[model samples]
Target chain A: MTNWQEDIVLDCSGLNCPLPVLKTKKIMDGLDSGQVLKMISTDPGSVNDVAAWAKRTGNELLETVADAGEYTHFLKKRH
Target chain B: MVETAGKKKRMALIASKGTLDWAYPPFILASTGAAMEMEVGVFFTFYGLTLLKKEISPKVSPHSNPAMPMKMPFGPDGFQQIEWPIPNILTGNMPGFETVATSLMKQTFQKKGVATIEELRDICIESDVRLIGCQMTMDVFGFSKDDFIDEVDIGGAATFLEFAAEADIQMFI
Candidate 1:
């Protein structure tokens, strides 16, 4: 776990594929290095989509939790 | 691309069909872009006009692509991964797979409270997102000037190309 595992929260509930990922990208672009973004989404594809964006955009997925059918993806932008 | 308060993104939605799957990327991007206040436009060509047609636009489905997608037994919207010979069709005139996918999306968005086709068109209009109907394609497809929604601006390939080229961000979906 990284230090950023506890900081930003982006609740993208009711959003579907691509929007969540696209919104995640926008957030990551705004934050500084080491800042974290926690994305809350109801889209089932977000797990794969966020992971793919992280891999492609050089961000890091610190952790992921799925509870009560909601998915929360934790990501730390790589410097 | 025209400048906005935040970031400016120029997107080119090459809407080729009116299928639900095909309709999505454009609508999502347009709505999301406008929601973010970005200047966006979608150029509808071929069968994509159904998105604006009031009489039967809601009923529009694929007349070609067989591999169009919808919700699956255990996955999300348009997330199912299957391959076909073409993006919107396989081998015949049958709507086949794309129908299921598009229909499901309509249902999903309705459930999720996103705008309907008409509402989306209104949003695009109010948001200043350009909705251009392909003039050449319309001619090629035998669509008259009266065949489109009132919001669409008719333009030929040269016009669209010029407009698309001037955009800071462009995408052909």
Candidate 2:
């Protein structure tokens, strides 16, 4: 998958559920519309939680790549 | 996409337990719901009102909780995976067993990167999730508003019901 240019990179490695999503929302709130964020998390639950959060909050989830136990997600801030 | 009928989704939660295990769900859901753009309110009633206290220290009690698996938080993966089947007699009669259990559970949560209850509550406050303490409970328990965190609003059942009435999801946790 093509890597989208990210305005900020959030490393949530070793953090569990809700923290990753909460921190992601915090940073996303500070970004301009259409800006992309790259979030890396080691929590397995985030694979689904981040997608669900982006969907519910109307953010754009560009891509998610899972390598070993780590998951990398690219999300775009919605207007 | 615009909300259906242009109404924002709302979630109302009634927290009635004060144990360490019981405390996580309400705060976790409240914070997550707020992050999802939903208005969230958690009503702390009965023992749950203790959670709103400024110095919140919830502990796990293994006495009656037979299903709670006891595991060492600090160990190799294989060692950590082994669940020690603690006898009910020992857990029930042993002094300081509850404290040990609470610390072990906390250590496990920390090792697995779970957020503390305080952290989750802070996030909820930051996200504008309403933290409502039951007025009747405080009066019954002889607690003052000063006992709780400043971010919490002290209210009666009616206040929570008003929000829960308009909420899309309501849970008694």
Candidate 3:
């Protein structure tokens, strides 16, 4: 994981496909450009979903870590 | 090409099934598309029109439809743990079995923390996803404008096709 400080943290554990990315998008919309958000998810689908979400939303995915079936993603708002 | 260059990304989705299990795809995809700044439109055709109705909660029961897959939150191990055969005959024959099965499925969804159908519909509305009911199906089914939710619009196949033509992604669910 990157050392960048997170402006906000969203925990989407126990949620299934679409919820993690959907929740992330909702939270990211409120963030200003360059602000970072850390997302925690337990759904395996999120591994791909978060990456695609960041790309589609024009955000920067700074880091992604998977540990003990839990995934953590760090994203920076672009616009 | 240049005329469409500045336009926003768009998606057109067709919902053709009315089963509760089938209901998730169109709304989920629409909400996700909307979140990614895409203009999303969902066309509810045939039985799918039931989903647009006000105060009507459609249901799915594996007991009634043998082809319908049972989704348990516990994964493959959940099946092995139960050690039950496919199409449990007892459950299928029981009185009010559909109601029981539907409730069980709803409970599974809750345990998984997934959004409910109603919540997902609201999400679509909040995200500005357009919901269009098929005019032909509505007529055949004897449905009126008052049958659908306030956010729904009634349209024909041609109207949906017009939206589909401009969309970057098209899905039939």
TM-score of each: 0.53, 0.97, 0.89
Go through the candidates in order and give each one's C-alpha lDDT.
0.66, 0.93, 0.86
- Candidate 3 TM-score over all chains jointly: 0.89
Model 1, which residues run further than 4 Å from truth? A1-79, B1-7, B56-105, B108-115
Which model scores highest in TM-score?
2
Model 2 TM-score is 0.97
* Top-down DockQ ranking: 2, 3, 1
For residues A1-79, could you state the per-residue lDDT of candidate 2 as single tens digits? 7958999999999999889999998999999999999999998899899999988888899999999999999999988
- Candidates ranked by TM-score: 2, 3, 1
Best by DockQ: 2
Give candidate 2's error at residue B100 in angstroms: 0.6
Candidate 3 on B1-173: residue-level lDDT in tens? 12234678989999999877889899889988988788999999998999999876778767656665555445686563563445568667767867866786788888877888888999999999999999999889999999889999889989899999999999999
The residue-by-residue lDDT of candidate 2 on B1-173, one tens digit each, is 33453677999999999999999999999999988889999999999999999999999898878888888998688998899988999999999999999999999899888999999999998889999999999999999999999998889889999999999999999
Top lDDT hit: 2
- Model 1, B105-128: lDDT tens digits are 577576664556665566567667
The true-versus-predicted C-alpha distance at residue B147 of model 1, in Å, is 2.8
